[model samples]
Target chain A: MSSILKITDLHIAVDGKPILKGVNLEVKQGEIHALMGPNGSGKSTLAYALAGHPKYEITGGDIEIDGASLNELDANERARLGMFLAFQYPVTIPGVRVADFLRHAVTNRRDPDRKEGENLMPMREFRQELRGRMNELGMDPEFARRYLNDGFSGGEKKRMEILQMAMLKPKFAILDETDSGLDSDAVKVVSEGLSSLAGPETGVLIITHHERLLEFNRPQFTHVMLAGRIVETGDASLAHELHANGYTTVRERHPAEAAEEQAEREETLATV
Target chain B: MSTVTVNSAPSLPSGFTSDDFEVFLQSRVEPVWVTQRRRVAFELFQAKSAEELDPEEWKRIPARAFRPEKFSLTGKAAIGFDTAQLPLMQNRAEFEGAVVHVDGSATESRLTEQLAAKGVIFGDLATVLCQQADLLEPHFATKAVLPDTDRFAAWHGAFWTGGTVLFVPKGVQVDAPLYSLVALAQDGVADFSHTLVILEDGAEATLLEETASGSPDIAGLHVGAVELLVGKEARLRYVQLQNWNQKSWHFAHQCGRVEGNGSLQWTVGGLGSKLAHIHQDVHLDGRGAEAQVNGVTFAKDRQCLSYYTQQTHNAPDTRSDLLYKDVLTDESRVIWRGMIKVEPEAQKTDGYQRNDSLLLSPTSRCDAIPGLEIEADDVRCTHGATAGRVDVDQIFYAMCRGLTEHEAMHIIVQGFLQTVTDRIPVELVRETLDKAVEVKLGIGE
Candidate 1:
């Protein structure tokens, strides 16, 4: 049976302020979903919420895999359950080599019940797999010995995220703005990398602003979020139309939600 | 020999007194010069012990509960005690020489005949001083770690029991490295083991030393001193791993001096002790001298570890770099006060000192202060100190990659200490430090 990630009326808040209200989405295996929205529309919030970020409080609604709820799980537990998030800004852990970090990550993902201090995957096996993955992604094998993301360029950071995604091979992978802050060449590399990684066994949710990414992966479902709600859901054309014309028409079409977004903007402006 | 237990019966003197000093003196057989030096040092110890400690260095460390009289020098050697289990660098590599001291008495001392034939002296201080009195008389307690520096220095000078001494003749290089183990086997026994390394002009050597307790719950006291003297164009690498049990009090005055064009690489690992305070000093005494100091300390539970370090450049074209990394957890506290001093004649000198600390728990605390006193107008001196808890974002990032929270923390802590570990060039030292870190984190064998 193909695994399904179901988000039912998810109401999320940050520091006691509501951000995601009554958001509903469903993604099944072998499918690609695109999450598009204007700024502050909770696109990244939804991504972080799904990844079990401690700061993103799920005040209401349930996020489930198949039928089991992930409300009580932390990020590590979620990761062990085959939920992966390719961060918008991948964190830099100094003095930690890429190979060592991945060995632990891959070992934990492969053996979910493994306790701390248990043996990791053998070095020869893990190194071979990592080297192969790096080669497939056109990365220099020497990059595996460098500190994890420390002093990496913008494009290199993005590619590192993709590399982690490829290595973990999660059941459901969420790319949270993986293409943002990258040049055209980097975007192409990332897009191509994602294209090769997502297959029949994986479910992908690409939260992005650039149509360049969707142009390659070609999402089957495009959902537009405004005022912390998914105001519109459509096929590929909807994404292309939104990308070409921007969200003005969508705002006009959803007056109530757009008004709420406008009020939120003004309130944020007032606080600033 | 028989073992004498002196830890019991509080009716004895509460601290080091005139009677204890005399008794300690009578127990040792040495030359008249050594006895005269002890008399001077014993008077200094008495005076200094009565005076208040410098508040600048002792404000953060609470020593009011310390009862020095509870510990005494053992009259007889501790026999038949096994020291094979004390970890760190033992049986890990081949050494040119190895020395073991138990309860402030030499239990074993050996040196490869090849090195001994090459005019290298490696043995206990008592044996070496007796055999080579004319050769060692000038350098012993005279160049570095002066007896008048503080109470601990004077105390160690007056009553030092047994220690390791390594002397390499001019133009000779001892390549395989030497090992020293100082073990405390009896409760309430004070082990004042002194280490002195002297390398003549154009000579080179490396010495690795460690201190450990026979059992985890035995109460011990260590008032130790280490003096390293490097001659012109000579090089020396010294590592001291302080791995005492939690029921021990460790006080040490360690110093090193580098001559013209000589270099000293000093690494200190502070892993164990209930309370430890070390005053470390490095002197660039001649032109073009250089020194590199590395410190890695981990404090857990209710332990308190403090370090007062100074780097003094006295000649032109001198250089010194110091880096200390500390990790504290539970209710432990770590304090580091560092200074770089440049003399007026030391123009064009380069000095740098930095200390970074990582706190792992809410109650764990660290106090780091870096200062510089530069009288040379044409010198570059920089100092920095930073103390922060482990970044939650870094932890979360690691956790997202499938590590449990504890494992993630362990990895981050290891990463934090890797910067200083990189500065150490010895593979044996690096590997031993890694294993010590793992054991301290409660994760490895």
Candidate 2:
């Protein structure tokens, strides 16, 4: 299958600090990619830069969605281009209700292939779909009436984000530390929710520290990012290796081998 | 709330003092009741020495042009609205209730025909006092919105000929809103109208006062007053819509006194006029009284809108809440000063006040002054004011959803002001307010 997201030599900075340096990665449709690294390894920064967050500047890199350059798009444009981000700490918008916001997002990110005069979906049908997704994510019915993430518990907020991602069903989704603050039960629920939403038409990249999530979701590929660059890449087993021995073995084995490992991973994925 | 006076309030004084405007008021009012109030207002007003002018003694009014009495109020011309087939009247007409038709500063003569059969006293200030002296004597100037209020009040009390007096008997409820159109129809005529509403104990009614002006080049002044007395268990809603000409100056004072267990809800929508000032005072004299004051102002093109609202909790267990928001664009400016005062013995009082503003343009300004005076230890009183520019991130968020920059701003500003409009109870009035907001924001055809 063709790659859903392709990033080459991605260099990104936030507040004058170079975060993502010389990063290369690709995710094919129907694949789960787990991005794992220690704290301050630029894992979350990469996700934010990929989502076109304003504070993060892409200095020298090329991000393409199905061979179309995404650099020219703003955050919403990126979202319209089938990109969604499940934030670690969701923003609380006081007066905006969850139902209204979901409706707005759906209308905003309509499929481009839709006929000019054809209607997308009726309000009732769209609402039913949203409610089903919410139920699947174990969210309460009253959550739809509340202000967007306003005063929600940590577990509830994470579930809400996953629910949004499931409803949006974007071509590419970047979960930026969605598992950071969640408890063990919440972690299982979120990982399962992502798998249920993932299909041949959608690709997901989960940036998290927990290897437990990888055990549940079963990522096809894994990448290790450190100090603004991807240093290693291998099959899902590499995550367990790094989990057990940490990045010290890779660092000591060949300090100069990190660059070659990342390039090889990109080349292998490109040819597939 | 204790009676402790404000000592360090900031003050802003200008050259055009209240005295100059007082002299202007002496020559305008003609009715007997109006003239009597004018004289009494003069003595009471003059007694307010320069000490009272100090900010600490009298709360800060907005800093704007003070020559309200100088502008000649051209008579109101007819105003035509493209309502697009909506019902002209919100409710069915009350056949047995007093009915008065006001067109600008002029009152229709046959208003008595429909009112005489029901023994309902409805007429202009002069006619009401002459024909129904027994009814007018006890009710006129009975509320706290007395003539002694600054120069505008004095002038309206002394010279207002377009004022309306309606007397609803005990247990008589008017199904339809008492409607009037005070149109600023002509050039250079100040239209000053007063409304005295007395809802006897247990009476229920709604009074809708709609004010608008049409001529572009005409400079008009509308200094109006409304005094309402809501008796025990009585419910009264007064909706005031001010859509005057952009070149006109509008100032109004409304005071509603709520007796034991009575409730009053005041909704004011300020969408037009070059400069406007509104002072609303609610005095809860009896226990268990409740009052809600919600106001919205749209200021654009260097217009200035100032609002001063006060909720006095005089009796124990009384509750009052206020919310005022303004959307400023271009060089428009707004100042909202809201105060919740609880008497010393008014224990268990619940008073809350909030004033927020949204600045749509770089040149626009908004100042919110929220205050509280709590003398009782067992009371809950809170006040907060916030001034914020439209959030760029929020605008961008909407824009990414396919809205242009202007469209995004329109939506954000609408959301900012919708917090205030959501409190209005009447559906027709809410729709009207929404339409007025769209016109102000230059949105929707």
Candidate 3:
């Protein structure tokens, strides 16, 4: 199987306003790609669009997973197609317990082609798998008894997302700002956890605004997005360059794109 | 829209005329005062029909849609129901006292020797009326709830054949909880039962009353009443579980009065009935009294459940808190109209009530109206109502793990209703409610 995600001339919009315009990318299994950008640079947009978020409209271009189109699929369908997007802000469901929710998710995702009501993991095995993964992530044993994401701290929510990643083990995983709300020590823990969870057959696209996360989970390629477009692409050294000299050189390198973004912002402010 | 049939008045049930009432009256033996009250109630019931005046909000309830003529009053005699065969009430050795009533007749009555020594009265109403008429008369259908309150009360007053009378004497604290099972087994019969609980000064006890039917889809009618009298400094935990069959239409009027420094904890579970309408009220009548009311209603498959609750703070320095949660699925509908009223003299009172509705199906509808009427100055009163569908993302999140839609729904619903079930302090009662939830969801398989 060709475990490659090919994105060509992708034009995406939010509520009819263009966000990711003519974006192009290619991701293959057994590789890690880091997506870094300023605020509103459409980094998260690419992740959400690939995850089939209804609000992010794909106006042009196509996303192909091993030559299969995912433009018309729903989030769940995309997930079944070996694509996963960890939410930047996980929604809290008051009544549902964490352990039970994950069991059902794991049950359905393991056999992607299994028919409904077939191949559900028995309770004993499911509980053991859940506890094993939870312990690996250093999550409290009682965490499974708590309601999903209800009253959880910021770092806890981030760790929960990573724990889910460890359990689901999708072919392609997109971690959106997984270290946003975490302290340095917590970020190191999450990065290490993600490293151990992924393998030769797994592909990861880490979206972030800081290079701190990239220190632990080294990405093979680093891409910088500005105003809905990826302007520069380089090896891991590019991230070190950005961390040292900052994005000043990228802005200077892509003056045309920068000018266009300034004009768009002015027009939006005028309309408002 | 114009294809609907409109009836201005609902007719009385077939074969239930004045002559039938006379026959029913003559068939039973009772005291003169009881007979007089029955005659008065029957007269009032005859003079009025259910359509004349409604609670306005009760329009959501399907009680009026039922034709009284469809059910037969002359059902198999109440004795035809065998309580001993009930699987629900079979393994209850932990209960201090156990009384089982089948179709308005006591089939089993037993009490621990220690409770009997303490003068704890746990028996059928008919037996109480004969054995302790002096203590029973002063509280039955007199103060906690009047016989002339409504049609259901009047009907119960005219024909209350089988019920429970539990009396915990002054300062007597029964260590083990008492249990009562009111099971409707026969077809086309009306169950007019009453539970009158009287707690003397400084007494404390726990009581669980379960309403269930051994058969499913058996046409049944239940017009019942429950009156709890918590005397000064007394404490009582009252748990009522209503799990009738799908073919049953039930109506109940339940009220409790708390005297000075008394405390009342009332937990209710409504998981059955094709159509049910109930009015539950609590009055903090004496100073320093406190009351907490909690209930869970699980409705499924074209069922209509309605509950009208009121917490009236009538005395100073009293507190009342109420929380009721409902989970509805299929084409089921639920209505909750709750009010917290603080009187002028009830200063320094704190009253709170909240009703939340969880809709499992798109077609299920819920109406939760919460209100507060306060005439007192120094008081804290709050009420809230929420009606919402189960969060879709929650379902999707669960499905992503490996669960089918049905399995995900079961988990979400059980978690949603745990808010009220957890309030049931008694372990056994909570277990029974848990089993009911499992049965309703069809998940145990």
Candidate 4:
């Protein structure tokens, strides 16, 4: 499998409100790329649009896995092609235990040709692997029996995301603001868990607003986005630079583009 | 043994009238009380003009599925063929005994000698009526469901046949469930059935009753009645599953009475039928009594099903809780109207009821109506209702995990229904019902 996710001049909108405007990026296998920007910079939108969310229309450009385009595929069809997106806020589904839900996902993800009504994995093998993953992530085995993300705390939900990631082992995975709302302790635990699961076979795109998540995974490449476009790219030190100086330096480094975007926003506001 | 052949056996596009009722009575030689009750109900049935029964409550129910005259009252269920020859139920190994009624007759039955030695009588009501008149005379149509309640109730009283009665003596507890299958084996046949269950003081038992029909092409009529009496501290779990074909129309009145310290759990599943109107009510008449009415209904195609339920806390310290969930697809429709009432003398009564429905198609409809009538000051009563489509985020989340759209929706829908199906207690029955739900959703084998 060609473990690379290619995006070219991507543009997206939510109900006709354009969020990602002319964005370009590439994430290759064994590389953890960090996309850091302020709130409303469209980091989460890019993540959702990549995952084929129906609400986020892809009006321009394309996203390709390997050499094939994903524009025509539905979310589940895309999922079968080895793509996974952990939501900023995982949806709550009550009365469905975590173990059962994960079993369905694991089988479908692993066995591309598996048919419905046939269990993908046996109970014994699934139970052993699930418990092993839960223990590795410091998750109580009891959480597997609980309803999926229903009434789960912020820390627990993040842990659940990591647990699913460990189980599905997707070819390409995107973590969307997974570090938000997590305490320092939870961040440390979740970061360590993600690090242990990351390797050469799986490409990852980590979208975040701060450097707290970068401290654990320590991305090799950092891209700073503003006004729905990537304005700066540098080595790992760029994360510390942005953390130390915040977005002021990044904004000053691209003054003309910043002013152009500012004038466009004012023009749009005046028209409204 | 006596058998009666009533009014002319005719084919469809016709209906039942007063003359048919007269012929039905003339053909039978029953006790005076039975005849008198039937006469009273027949008169009431004849007197109910379309306008008199035109209350807003009955408006949602469409015109009767089949006119009465088109159906033949072939007498107490006497299936010309043995019920064992039919393949309706599977896994009969767990039951202590079983009874099967088809085409208006009891064809196959297994009443264990151990149960009979315990003085437990389980069989067709017609047979029980002849052999145990003392037991049937006082309690029949007297306590749980009255004979003169409505047109359907009176019609069932006048022409009911092929019913079952389960009587458990004081302190007798059956270890395994007693199974009964009432099936319609032919087209244009009407079945007016009654199921009576009585548990004496300190008695306990479980009954799994299944109601089904032959196929979708068989346009049948079923007007049924069920009465359950739980004596002091007695316990009972009754599971009623209805799987009629789309060509069948069903209307039933089911009621239960619970005495002091007794508990009753009624688990129902409605998976078939073209159009059904069901009325279920439970009365907690003694202190410390409790009753629970939990059910799941899955409907597809043009099926229309409505349930009107009541939970009456008539004694102090009594409690009643009900939860009814439905899943609808295609152009199907569901209506749920539930009321919880606390009497003035029923202090410290706790009552709760709610109905939730999931509509898969935009054109499908669900009307969930919940009401509370509180006459006691020291009572806690609450009613809740919700009707909405399936959650898109839930579906998307499932899709993200590798399930196809249909698979995702099916899993989520099954989970939505498992909230009630999981409480069925019997492992085989629960799995069977789950599979039935999947089939209704057009998924799984």
Candidate 5:
């Protein structure tokens, strides 16, 4: 049976303020989902909550894989359960090489019970596999030796996130704005990279505003978020309509949620 | 356990009294000149010990509990004590020569025949001093690490014991590195080991040395000195790994002088010791001379490690670059006071010094002070120091990729030290330092 990631009535808050209010969604292996929303719509909050970020308080939620709940697990435990998050703003870990970081991640993902300092994958085999993956992603093999995300360009950082997803091969991968702040060519690269990496056994959730990303990896299901909640669920054509048009039509159809989003914007603006 | 006698009673003053010095001198068989130098140093030690230590250097370092009377110099080396088990760079790479000293006595010293044919001298300091007195007399104490600098220097100068010495003849390049191990195995043993390396004009060599205790429970003391003299147009790479047990007290004055067109690369790894304070100096003494110094220190538990470093530019066109990285955890503390000085005649000199520290726990503390003094108007000098905790975001990012919290922290701490590690060119030294870091983090084999 295909592994299932079930999210039921998920409520998440940041610093005591509700950002994701009663979000319910279910994604299974091999399915591609697109999450679309305006700014402050809690799109990223859901992504962080699913990855078990400590800062994202799960006020009321049940996130599970197969049958085991992940609400109590930390980010690392969730990662070991085949959940991966491609951060929109990838962190720079100075002095840590890309190859070394990926090797550690890959080893842990393969053997979840392995303790720290235990044997990692053999260097010969790991190097071969990493080299092959980098070749497939069109990344310079020299990048393997460079420090992770240190002194990298925006496009390079995004591509690195994709590269990590490829290496991890998570059962459910969430790309949180992995294609934002990139040129069209870079977007095409990331889009095509995600398309190639998300295979039959890998479930992908693309969190992006760029049409180029959805143009390549056409999602089977599209979820539109508003006011910290999933206000609408639709198909690929709805994504196309929302892309060609904008959230204005969706807001017109859902006035109550739109008013709540307006109220959130006013409160944020007042504080700023 | 030893009982402490009250001061009211006329107890032979706790540590290194005149009686102890006289007896120590009687045990050594050396030339008249060496004895004369020791006597002078002994007088200086007496005078300096009476005076207060420099408040500027000792104020931050706590030494109230350190009782010198508790430790005494051992007259004999421990039998069957294995220096190989201390482990830093031993058996990690091929070396042209190797030396082992335990309890301030030479155990094993050897130099490859091929290198010895090239007039390269590698042996214990005691044996080398007796055999090659004429060749070593000029550079031994006359240059770098003078005895009168401080009480510890004077004490070490007077009671200096067996250590490793490397001498490369002018223009000969000893490609492979050399290894030295100074160890202590018995409780209350004082190992005053000295390391001296000399490279003549256009000569090149590399030496790696480490200090260790036979076991963790042994309480020992090390009052040591290191002097490196690079002759004109020569090059030398020296690494000293200080990995004593937590019950050990280490005090050392290390200095390096680079002559005209010569270069010296010095790397220091401070891993173990209850409390250690190292005074390190690098002198660019001639035109076009250069020195690159790198330090990696990890302090944990209640340990306190301090470094007072100086880089002096004395000639025109000289260059010196120094970088020190430290990691602290538990209630441990690390202090770094660095200074760069440029003499008036050292015009067009380039000097750079920086220290970065990573604090792993809330209770851990780090104090970094960087200063510069310039007498030359046409020189470029810059220094900086930064102390910060490991970024929680970086930890989260690593955890999101599947590393446990401890593993993530270990990796982050290693990354923090990678900047200095990159400056070192020796693969064996780098790997050994990495492995040592793993051991300190309580992980790895």
Candidate 6:
């Protein structure tokens, strides 16, 4: 089976700083791919680069989604093509009701025929559907009435992000450290939500530091990112090894490997 | 016969002087109280001066550049809207109590037939003076607004021709809304009007005043005044939605006086007009009285303007809050000068003033002058002003979500101004405001 996402020689940088020097990755449909690394290893950067964040600056990249190059597309265009990013820390927007925002998002994603003559969801129907989705995520009904993420606790914000992901139903989702700052219970709830979203047509890339989260929602593929590039790729057990041995030992074992890999990538790209 | 030019100046009265006001007042059939007050108010009006071009304060206001003599009167029967009944469309009938409509010159509206049975009087001030004169005398500019402040106030007081007088008796809760519209017609004409609202003890009602011109290009002037009186334990919500044509100049003064335990809410949405100035003053005169003022303006192109407001706390434990927001694009400019004043005897007062602006282009300018004067030791007063462009992070977030740069910015700007739109009691008005904002953003189809 072909991969839903293919990133070959993906190099990204911010302000001239090498964030993702040369990274290669593959995400097959229905698979929950875990990219684990220590701080500044470009875990979140890789996710942002894949989602077409403007600041990422794809220096040398050939990111293809089912054999189509996505480097030229803007973020929203990428989203329309079934890509979604749940920020590590969802921004709080005051005065904008969550339900209104969700309605706008849902309307934007609906087929033209579905929106014919009634683009805006009726308030009653919108409320009913929002309540149903909130219930599915084990959220309070009042959560939809308040400002989007305004004054929400950290856990509540993460859950709201997951709720949006569920509502949007994107073909590909990048969950950026959704487990961070969440209690074990919240982590379990969020993991379960992500698990239910997985299907044969949707590929998810979850960036995290905890193996516990991976254990809850076992990923089909796991890769260890270090120094802006993926140094090792394996099964879900790779998370356990990184958790047990630490990144320092992994680096000492292959101190010059990343540098050698970078030179080779530069040579190949220079020729191409 | 010689062919006549259609661009000739509009016909004027035989004489336009303050003496015309005295003669008009003398013909009143009621006692001399209201007439005497109008005479005294006219004297105060004649002695005052037009706002001096204070470059440091009002240089950016569009009013400074308008030629006052160019404004004309609105022509014959501009819109056939019955000035007496509610001007509200069908969608706004749910939350309102009562509604009234009045043109600039005369109160063609006579809501007294429907509402008078329920002890509500909605009609022209002159008719109220002839009929309900005794009741109207006590509130004919007796609240927070004084006529001696500016040239426009004096003009409105001395030559005011048509206005509305709303009297909601004690314990009466009006379920509909009241509307007062000042229609400026004909080029080089001026319309002066006033609206007096007295909410009796424990009474509740919503009063809305709309100002507009017959045509977008017709030069006209409006010097209007509105005074609202909130009796003890009464509640009044006053909304002013002004869409004066771009060629018109609007000078307005509105004041509210809150009695003990009474509350007053004032909202202003200024969208059109080449030069406009509104001085909104709220006085918390009675203990535990509260007042809230929210205003929003959108200035584009070369429109210049300044908005000044004062939130005064005169009685102990009284509270006042004021918020003014503006969006400037092109070479347009805006200045928000606001102050919170707490009297020396007013202890435990709470006052807050906020003025913010969103600059859409590099050339557009905004100035916010937020001030506080605290004479009471136990008062809590705070003022803040912020002027900025759209947040790049927010724009990027929207863009990344598939919206173009323009779409993203439009959403952000709408979000910024939603506070003003959300307060409108009528859904159609809110939607109209949304569409206007979209038009001002240059994103509308």
Q: Pick the DockQ winner.
A: 5
lDDT of 4 by residue, B1-445 (tens): 1111122123212334567767877876567777787787766655442324545666776643345556776764543644454333445445777877787677666789999999898998777777887788888888987866776787687777768889999999987889988888787888888999999999999888888776558878888999999999999999888888888888899999999999999988888888888999999999999998888898899999889999999999999989998999999999899999899999999999989898999989998889999899999998898887889998888888888778878877877876776667776578767777878877654
Q: Tell me the DockQ of each model, to 2 decimals.
A: 0.70, 0.17, 0.30, 0.63, 0.77, 0.31
lDDT of 1 by residue, B365-426 (tens): 99998999999999999999888888888888888888988888888888889899999999
What lDDT tens digits, residue by residue, belong to model 3 across residues A62-174? 99989889888767667766787777888787767888777667766776666544556788998898899988888898999888899998888888888888888788889
Residue range A123-188, candidate 5, lDDT tens digits = 999999988888888999999999999999999999999899888889999999999999999999
Interface RMSD of each: 1.1, 4.5, 3.6, 1.3, 1.0, 3.3
Q: How close is every model to the real structure, measured as TM-score?
A: 0.95, 0.80, 0.81, 0.92, 0.95, 0.83
lDDT of 5 by residue, B1-445 (tens): 2112121113333557788888989999887788888999988877777666787788888766677778888868898887767676887876768998889899989999999999999999888999999988888888998999988899899999888899999999999889998989999999998899999999999999999889999999999999999999999999999999999999999999999999999999999999999999999999999999999999999999999999999999999999999999999999999999999999999999999999989999999999999999998899888889899999999999999888899889888888899889999989999998898888865
Query: What 10-residue stretch in candidate 3 chain B is worst by lDDT?
Result: B1-10
Model 5, docking class: medium
Q: Fraction of true inter-chain Cα contacts (below 8 Å) kept per model?
A: 0.69, 0.12, 0.40, 0.65, 0.85, 0.42
Greater TM-score among 1 and 2 belongs to 1
Worst 10 residues of 3 chain A by lDDT: A111-120
lDDT of 6 at B20: 52
lDDT of 2 by residue, B1-445 (tens): 1111223112211211355445555545445655566667655543432223345423443433444334543334344432222222323232233223333444343333443454444456556666777767777776667776664575466445566666666666655556544566555567777877777777777766666654567677777888888888888887877877787877788888898898898888887788877788999989998899888888898788888889999999999988888889899888787888888878999998998888888999987888888888899988888888887666654533333456556556656776787898876677777677767777654
Which CAPRI level is candidate 4? medium
lDDT of 5 at A254: 90
Position A36, candidate 1: lDDT:
96
Model 1 segments more than 4 A misplaced: B1-15, B77-79
Order candidates by DockQ, high to low: 5, 1, 4, 6, 3, 2
lDDT of 2 at B253: 86
- Model 5: CA > 4 A from native: A248-272, B1-13
